[model samples]
Target chain A: MKLHSLMLAAGLAATASMGMAEKIKVGMITTLSGGGAGLGIDVRDGFLLAVKGNDDIELVIEDDQRKPEIAVQLADKMIQSEKVDVMTGIIWSNLAMAVVPAATAQGKFYVSPNAGPSALAGKGCHPNYFNVAWQNDAYHEAAGKWASENGVGKVVVMAPNYPAGKDAITGFKRFFTGEIADEVYTKLGQQDYAAEIAQIRASGADMVYYFLPGGMGISFMKQYAGSGADVQVMGPAFSFDQGILGAIGDAALGVKNTAHWSKDLDVPGNADFVAAFQAEYGRLPSVYAAQGFDTGLLLASAAAKADVADADAFRAALKEADFQSVRGEFSFGANNHPVQTIYVREVVKEGDVVTNKLLGAAAENHSDAYAADCKM
Target chain B: MSTLLLIEQVLNGLQFGVMLFLMAAGLTLIFGVMGLINLAHGSLYMVGAFAAAATAAATGSFVLALVAALIAAAAAGAIVELTVIRRLYDRDHLDQVLATFALILVFSEGTRWIFGSFPLYLDVPAALAGPVTLPGGIEYPAYRLLIIGMGLAVAAGLFLLISRTRIGIQIRAGEADREMIGALGVDISKLYTLVFALGAALAGLAGALVGAIQSVQVGMGEPVLILAFVVIVIGGIGSIKGAFVGALLVGLTDTLGGVLLPEFFALFTEASSAKLIGASVASMAIYILMAGVLIFKPTGLFGGQT
Candidate 1:
């Protein structure tokens, strides 16, 4: 009986030692299957690529399925069950809003790979939350400024009728003080834009600004081209980025878009990123990929600065905003959102690839307008 | 609006209506004949799209990809019918709904397992790549025109097949009285398989055609499937003519609502407020239409006898 008891005690000590050596857990939730899968997949791949040689972090992946309820549920499970030290990779603002507060409430470090909802950027900002991407409305605000500077009068604005859509229109209107001919909102996943195009033609708008992303953007662009309207069309990066280039093809040519990072940006970090991503995926890295890669690097930098096993320490380290992103030098604001550049770009046919080329840099390390509301 | 723009919008509405019809026809047929609501029908559409994309990527032939899509979707339908659907024929609607919902989970996860969660894209064929100038100086995509033509051809073929053939009589009889027809020596099981495969084939064709224009990935079918359900519901479930009319109504209403609502609001409110209100109302137009229809005609416009 004595020998059996001694064996049991030794077994418990061995198991405890093994537990101490286990990798630090990180939870990553993103939309991995659905219409938004392209962007989410790229972000997931970029994050994985960033952690290629890192042996300390163990990633636990979950798919939110592009639903806010599911995201909140998953965030809860990640925090209470999985007991992850940090959480990351939310693609949509609605989903981000659902998960960010929950993760932060649990005192887990939450790093956003893509979404930067205005609410979290301002009054709702949490110390445990950190966005590696720019504010959701920042790019559109830059586009509005560019349109004003270029003398684009009588501009008609359109976006899918949703919270994000409203944010986009408000962002555009922030800087453009021209004659607003019309503002139109369509269903969030609308596949047709014929009637909208007809209205744009009838309204006599000189240019049309829109903020449709992913599959909706492709469908809208195709129908817009079919409408035979000659009015200039423009949007932010999400409307005509690398993901939709293959689907949109020549239809996207000459379309103006605004974004933070383009494939052709001349910085050495950008060039290296573009080359590495192209070499790895055989396609140019999109702003989504760049943001995701930066997110991974950001996490790694924070981990290096503090003991990742100590969750509170890691969270504080990330909040300190010490990392180099491919979008050039950027730092987190008090609201846990990045102050980043936004560029106005034009879609052009270069060789066989249709891509967005930088037309002009519109805003430099610009913070969101809602930053004032965020008392973080 | 300019004449050209009006003409283009009309064509767009027609094109959208055609796509919705492709989805609705199969749903109405299955519901009419089987008396079962199969929510997993969208899973078949996703399967067809992924199959087409994978085959096309491998062979570099759009024609082969389309053929593969049809075969794959049909095969999947038949297998699902034999394993899961056959048992649910006599069950209540609640059971059928639950079973099909489970099937959706299986199909979606199975698809993800095979495709590794990446979107597969199919390219538009060179034969129908560019925009063609139509009458009234309106430019339309040749591929879209092809889709519209294919939809019409299928509609005509379905009408002929239902009216002019011996199997058509069996199908009609089966729809009217299943037990009596089965007792009369017709093999009902084989007939059920045939109908399911046919419905799956139609859905597959729609998926393959649309896959060229959009990203082919998991869960691509859910939205269209819901819209198709709305079409069939408005058209009267199990009625092909109703499906066609319902699809067109929805297509036009949804397309025009987005454009007209904001302008109407602009008359009374600021431009931004008008847009917000108009868009919100436009998004709810179809649901409002559905509710209005249900209030007056509880059985749907052409739903034979509720």
Candidate 2:
């Protein structure tokens, strides 16, 4: 009996040594405390749901407090001390810009669940970097296309005065091909929209396109509703996502927004994702949640095929993007950003909950314009 | 822009200025009367907003929401004043600042623990949810117009209270010389508590009013607090009249600069770059005004003491 037990122990040790269980350490730095915490919480919950019951993957999560410097410090700590194999979960573009380049340069793999800035999609693209979310311009570009194709004309464009804001306007103009009545750049995180609403009402434009996200969107929608502005409103999904829809209330109803995914999309794995997310988090998932779940699945698929120790093999495996995405027909562009169909969604009241209902596709096989600028 | 549009923009400026005045009033009052720099005044504003939002959610009454805001903020101010703030009266400015800053963190975290991080839904009352036309054919938001009226009314009430009431006399006397008032048989600690609660109630009222139009979430008060500080500095630190005028000046500069500067640059440069340059300058317009004022009069517009 002793000889048999010794032989069994030796066999188990041999199997473990042969890499039967692969462990991948994941470091998630996100805004978990502050105004932007909702987005990060959703992303973290969705990511965890996808990797549930998997003991092989260890995730180290830290709150960034919506500060770029804190995010940089966390990234450095994750890379230097935690020695994480992969890093993810940055929501804002500025924070992503602060953390991603440095992490990727230090030989740490970064899979962005959101915030695909133009710089990273273009000349600053790194081999170890993968953006599971759409490029910064993709949704806005799709919104522009939907506006132009749906008989909308004479639009006033507004965005925060930042790089992503500029990218939003540029992307909209790329496919809009309509009379641009005016372009307004407001201060970032500004709550008051009275002046802007006054301008919109006076611009004589039939439609107003804006890209204010998070709480700013809520403020704008509420103020715009009260102002009795006669113009129609449209924006990207960031402003109308499930997380903030309740706060916007009925003001967001019937407003059109473009996104790469929706809760009602008739796609494989989407219904399951929505149902599972609701079951786990006891709430409807937002677009940010969808991106995070897809990111997890993609990482899982890559990890199943290749060990992360082999950088070249892991990169090739990630490039394949073999997992089923909630967005459906997902593929990575040459720049490692997502290339997928963008859908137009309308904010609707379903039962008692405010959510999005898929309207139709705005753009098919939509790829970013900056992909050509990437060398690798 | 058309004349009507420009007039509407000015109204927007006035509306914004009125809101800033509400915040600056309380801050200036506390600083003037207490001789203590309270960095946590914004936290009191946040507390009021959260209280109002929660009350509105529960009872579905706007008036009840406002009342709850005032009561909750005043109670919080009294408790904080008695428990934490009373101990810091004799400390140096740096120590007071550090302690109040710590109080801000505590309030922020405590509120987050109770309310979560998502912004609460606070809508304009249905009666005031439409546009009101002014005499010049300028359409303005009725809610904003109401805010301006309320602010003016409060300003008038505050002036009257300061000029007529016995407590106002006591407060003025305390501001002048706290030790002298205490020596004259006045309960100085109780007066200090009352003053703090009064300032907090005003801040709470401002928060509830503005939260109806803006996002009611954590950190919402900090930006307004910064603006309030700018108003007091540009005006005079301890002068309510100065706060009122300074808030309006800053508001007009911010709004008009944002709207007109871009238009002004359109004549000399292309539209997009003009917007870039104009916005960059406009964001600095208030700071520039503050600097210009300081360069001319280092003691501020209405400052009396060195």
Top TM-score hit: 2
The TM-scores of all predictions, comma-separated, are 0.89, 0.96
User: CA lDDT, every prediction?
Assistant: 0.81, 0.88
DockQ of 1: 0.49
> TM-score of predicted model 1?
0.89
Residue-level error in angstroms, candidate 2, position A321: 1.0
Say which candidate scores most in DockQ: 2
TM-score of B-chain for each predicted structure, in order: 0.97, 0.98
| Tens-digit lDDT string for candidate 2 (A217-236) | 89999999998887999999
lDDT of 1 at A135: 86
RMSD of each: 5.9, 5.2
> Per-candidate DockQ versus the true complex?
0.49, 0.74
